[model samples]
Target: MSKFLLSALFGAAVALSSSAFAADQTLAEFHADMGGCESCHADGASASADGAFEFEQCQSCHGSLAEMDDKHKAHDGMMMCQDCHVTHEMNVGQKPTCDACHDDGRQ
Candidate 1:
């Protein structure tokens, strides 16, 4: 292959690999990077007082709870996405646990 073609392929590969989780990036930071907090907020100015707008934004991107796996569907109508999936408090690859709410001691 030509040197130019090889370099282009290498660049594309690097871009795709970097699309995965960033070691120290929080979910909130990831979302903010996409289009700023406004991507999840109403106008990038502030979070909703009741979080209703932010909740809608989450659903718009990730789909509604009823559309997710059983772990998420189980909480449909009971809580907002932030209740368990705290992006601001969680890292990109981290997931929320029942311990955040449930106390049955099941790990």
Candidate 2:
């Protein structure tokens, strides 16, 4: 291939990759759009002290672990937020249901 054609292809590839990266928002962005950082951070300035926003942190706002346990007791509470909300972007309808992770035989 000509040098010019090769350069064009490389440029296009870079642009596509960068756009994909940009599409994923940062944690701070999610906090701003959703609510005050304290909702998840506990103390925004000292987040590390509290803990990184993992499944437990998400549970604070979405629902209590106990609530989930009660609701999903039949399924043995074998689901996690990540199973549905694949990314922090968290769009509705993008999430999967119990059936997605559980077997068809599950009650």
Candidate 3:
């Protein structure tokens, strides 16, 4: 391929890669951008605390679900929220995934 053509192809590849990265958002930023989960998990039976149990606040206590603990080194943080506790509708015995997040007892 000619140098000019090669350069154009490389540039296009770089642009696409950068765009993909830009689309990715950090967990904290995701929650901040959403302006809290009250929209879906708010009011009546689905009411969540104003400041408590928000995704951001949960991260503070739970830490990222994908991190190292005493027993396990890698956990799936991406699915932590769904893995534990039912949001919007409370069940009588709903418990957070202690073992799933912790993988051991350290967390």
Order the candidate numbers by lDDT, best to worst: 1, 2, 3
Residue pairs that clash (backbone atoms under 3 angstroms), model 3: 66-77
Q: Tens digit of lDDT per residue, candidate 2, span 1-95?
A: 45874575577558656764333465445444445565455555444442436456666544644566544444335555554565345543343
Q: Which residue pairs of candidate 2 clash? A: none
Number of the top candidate by lDDT? 1
lDDT, model 1 = 0.78
TM-score of 2: 0.37
Candidate 3 lDDT score relative to the true structure: 0.45
User: What do the candidate models score in CA lDDT, each in turn?
Assistant: 0.78, 0.51, 0.45
Shift of residue 15 alpha carbon in model 1, Å: 6.5
Instruction: Identify the leading candidate in terms of TM-score.
Output: 1
Clashing pairs in 1: none
Q: What TM-score do all the candidates reach, one by one?
A: 0.76, 0.37, 0.26
Per-residue lDDT tens digits for candidate 1, residues 61-97, read 6689999999889989988998877878888767788
User: Model 2 misses residue 76 by how many Å?
Assistant: 6.1
Native-referenced Cα lDDT, model 2: 0.51
